[model samples]
Target chain A: MTSDSRLSWRDVRDRIHEHILTGRYGPGDRLPRDADIAEELGCARSTVQRAMQDLSDSGLVERRRKGGTRVRAEPVTRATLDIPITRREVEQSGARYGYQLIRRRMAPAPRGVVAAFGLGASRPMLRVEALHLSDGRPYIFEDRWICPETSPEVNDLDFTEESANEWLVLNKPYTRLDLRFYAVSANPRLSDLLETEPGAALLVIERTTWVDDAPITTVKAITTPGYQLLTGS
Target chain B: MTSDSRLSWRDVRDRIHEHILTGRYGPGDRLPRDADIAEELGCARSTVQRAMQDLSDSGLVERRRKGGTRVRAEPVTRATLDIPITRREVEQSGARYGYQLIRRRMAPAPRGVVAAFGLGASRPMLRVEALHLSDGRPYIFEDRWICPETSPEVNDLDFTEESANEWLVLNKPYTRLDLRFYAVSANPRLSDLLETEPGAALLVIERTTWVDDAPITTVKAITTPGYQLLTGS
Candidate 1:
């Protein structure tokens, strides 16, 4: 406590978190104002602000503009998931990554694809089907659609050497993203593609991105059986 | 652009986001300092700081303590998942909620349960099996384990009317949480409990919570077939 003025935001955050952990402030309890905490702890108000922001981001507390901050009455199990590029994800897991373009063409957006982008009318989208391999085994089979208006350069890329997943993540900056997770029983075609047994339960990650209301891309990455997506905070 | 003096943090955030969306600032580009952006926009430095915080939380930009901020070259698909209590979740989705406690007893921790808690040895813990329903149809089947030392009050509560999920969330304040998502093919027992066919693909959410390293509870909530979990930002 003697180094109160020198305490960093992390220190302040830990102190406040300890208070909650020790039952000093119970569930649904309103926390002290930023100014009061700053004055009492002998730290800058901005430091307290930073700590509170971290707590809010992690779903420990709820912050309102004028209503002040309070511990969440029914605390949620909050998790942040950061899905990376396919090749990078494979390589990071210590696998030798490979890519194979299964199909590529300019086709009218399908009903599902149109619905995913919230488009009123079907448009010609660059459809790319590819398989991401980790050490010669299929890791993910991606079926993707890219809008030509937003990503005209996608037409120029052959997609054989690099996946649309890798290329888009590197070149495009999206303003919005939607991600979904679900399970599906592998059909004959899917089982053959993923080299898994028929009726195997597989996890699917569906992602869509856009910029300024203009659709960029939507992809469904179907993984092999026994795939688990994990996050912790 | 001329209303710079009256701009709010949200306004500044949108302007900077516009630069990224319009390709004025490409991926991996370092953004201006908070002070520099404040001076350019004719706003207070705190305003820029607030805007940057928003961008960072959304995973659009990465902020370092002294290294400043930069546009992410590989933008991760960041999703925030708020898992709520089961009854509330069902009611919020406009469904008639129902609960039934299938079984409850103090039993020795199973191998998997001990491994989940990282305990040195197996001990007697409260094991609970319950089913959540929507309009008398099985929705989710939960297998749960609770540490009696951490949650002594759980013994007094009758879970027949209200689920253990809701009771713990309301009473216990966990300092740590671990969540896992995966898929499983329903076995005979699980199929009977969830009212699904054997070999049906189901989504499973495994959650574990701790208070200061003392394990509070761990539960595996297995949703009925065709359930999908989604998040967007």
Candidate 2:
């Protein structure tokens, strides 16, 4: 409750959250300053600041340089999503994972690939397609492109045994990443690849990574029907 | 770089990121201790610790309590998703927002709803079905259940003028939240409600929130066809 008691920042955060939940501070209500809250709670100002930061991060409060802090009128449900490598994802689902490289070739980046990478021009890149299986059933079909200029090591490794999904994730450390999730009705080609009926709904995860402004790789992980991604806050 | 230069933790983080990006510290490789890094970077040990925390948060590294920090063998793309209230989401996308309360009734919690809330037994709950519109077209159809015991104030609000989504977010601050994203093929009912073709692919955002041990609300916001949820890491 006080600095003398040494309440952790988490405890302080919970206390502030309690005030908001109890309607002592309603939506769009400006909260007491860190110094004021610290004085009232007998805690250090820094402790209050730490608690406020956590509250803001969780979308409970909005902090402004001039306006101090106010509870958000419509707080968002903020959640952190960590998307792991495909092998790990499959294994975590308690299924035997199998992977096979469908094809690998050096080809010019397509218009969509070029736009995804924001490349000025279409360029030759390593295009790899692979299938990931769970319990011997197709789980995900991945179409990927790797920029040779940034990840030149891909040119030397054959993807026959290791998927580009796992290989690039392990070998490359991207400084920037772009991720997207959407739903698509499977076309004939996709449906055949995924062993599903045509027009089956599929979830697609598109990701692109860059290291210091150089593109590392871009991939579309098209999941099988009924795949779901879960997270918590 | 070393502590005498008084470099900030952000500078230290960027320097460490560069080392990993340049292959100085390869995947699964351990780096110098915080003390050693501090000595090398001429910063305080606490500064290095702070940098390590940020690196771990961003999925660039994994820090153990005693094993020091190592580059993740397969770095997951970590992204924070802030799912705002539906009306705000529509408006934020530069579209005209509208809400219509389709149905509201006191209904016994269904098996799925009870399981979602982790309730011991099915109980009576206020079920609210609503449609959110963007540019006069259906954007999301939400089926939600509110626990009256936890949110007694909801009984007073007529949802025809104000949505339950906005009301709950403004009034309730939950201690816990569960979120899930998946694709669902529209059934006949959903197709008619959303004005989409039958079997159209739709993105479903399911969320459950709890205040301490009490369930607050659970909702399945099924987005219209072609709706994509995007984020970055």
Best by TM-score: 2
**Candidate 2 Cα misplacement greater than 4 A, ranges:** A1-35, A44-50, A62-74, B1-35, B43-54, B63-74
Expressed between 0 and 1, the share of native interface contacts present in candidate 1 is 0.69
Restricting to chain A, the TM-score for each candidate equals 0.82, 0.82
Query: In candidate 1, what are the lDDT values of residues B37-100, reduced to their tens digit?
Result: 9999999999999888877765778899789999987666667788878887788789999999
In order, what DockQ does each candidate have? 0.51, 0.61
Model 1: per-residue Cα lDDT at residue B203? 86
Give the runs in model 1 whose Cα sits over 4 Å from its true position. Answer: A1-32, A36-60, A65-67, A70-75, B1-32, B37-60, B64-75
Candidate 1's clash total is 0
lDDT of 2 at B92: 92
Q: Give me the displacement of residue B129 in model 2, in angstroms.
A: 0.6
Second chain only: TM-score per model?
Answer: 0.82, 0.82
